[model samples]
Target: MGIVRNGHEASDRWSYIRRFLGGVAGIADDFLGWWWRGKDTLSPAELAAAHEQWADRAEWRLAQRAEELASDRIKRYLVTSWTDSVAYTSRRLAAQARGELSEWIPQRERRPDLHTEARAIFADILTELNIQSQPTKEQSSVVHLRKAG
Candidate 1:
């Protein structure tokens, strides 16, 4: 038989059991409360609004990216064209200055229309240069929206 101490031992054992059970109950209650708070509570309209806002932001970002790419392409084309034109003009002017045109073209043949060629080349260069200097329409197409506080 188990030892008995005037019911004191049984009482102490019951107290320890109660304390352990109470701690477990408190923990369970806290977990349930947290789970309830963490549950999805958004209405359909709220969810839809959030999605629409995300899509709008995405579209705006894509448009901005496209504009940036277009600007870069235009810049590269302009620079390359300008460099090629400068090289060609330098070679032609140097050859003409050195009187090497006769070697390239027969003297008996009518001289090639240098004035017309020069005018055409300069016009093309100037047109492209002017275009490079001006802002593209895409740059101005961006819409600025002020956020409401």
Candidate 2:
């Protein structure tokens, strides 16, 4: 019965992990919907549809990345690390969405460097998905101001 009990315990642990991962994935989806809201003028339903598309693309990209890793263990670790990062970022974004926080960075100040980094990540995803990037008003003004300066 010890062998059966060990197998059951392992199965239970795997089930718990799967559920936790699903919750994190949901949080990431929620955060993406919130982020897309400020980027586009789409209605909530349309934004949700777009979010689904983007999520699928992201998953595909992540799978491709995982496949590049040398070992199955390393691939699993990479995917878990990526999932945890996304969950943490999503929590921060959700706080911002609820007006509990001001940017991801403190100080009520904009971080152009971080913004650029984020845009580059999104640009890669967009390029992979064959979607065009839309410049925000702030992005457009920054270009104009740079030219003027």
Candidate 3:
């Protein structure tokens, strides 16, 4: 009976852990999507959902892993989650700073204006993404601002 009970307990633990891990993986995916919202062409609601999902997943992962892993693993996960969140937040902040990415339309109507708009937006996006700097008065990283010729 002891062996049988132990087997059942192990099975239950495995099932719980598997579900927890699945949730973590799902959140990680959502975080990636949210981070790459501009690049991926996800809708606003979709992006929001991704952010929420990632938060949920990270919280769940932390709670579950808190008990099982060595303190180092828990710390690693915490750091990983924090870094991922920062990356996602930074991407969104950068996109918002660019202003051209207000609405990320994946299938833009192929008009001549679309090309011009995309070029401008791309330049702005690249500037924000490429040029890393300290936050400015506006609390956003300084990207090169084109002076009026």
User: Please, what is the whole-model Cα lDDT of each candidate in the order they appear?
Assistant: 0.38, 0.44, 0.43
Question: How does each model score on TM-score?
Answer: 0.22, 0.29, 0.29
Q: How does model 2 score by TM-score?
A: 0.29
Candidate 3 segments exceeding 4 Å error: 1-41, 69-149
In candidate 3, where is summed lDDT lowest over 10 consecutive residues? 1-10
Over the stretch 39-116, how does candidate 2's per-residue lDDT look in tens digits? 355454444443343334335436545645546543454464464445445445334444455445431133354445
lDDT of 3 at 18: 25
Clashes of each: 0, 0, 0
RMSD of 1: 36.4
CA RMSD per model (angstroms): 36.4, 17.7, 18.8
Best by lDDT: 2
Candidates ranked, most accurate by TM-score first: 3, 2, 1
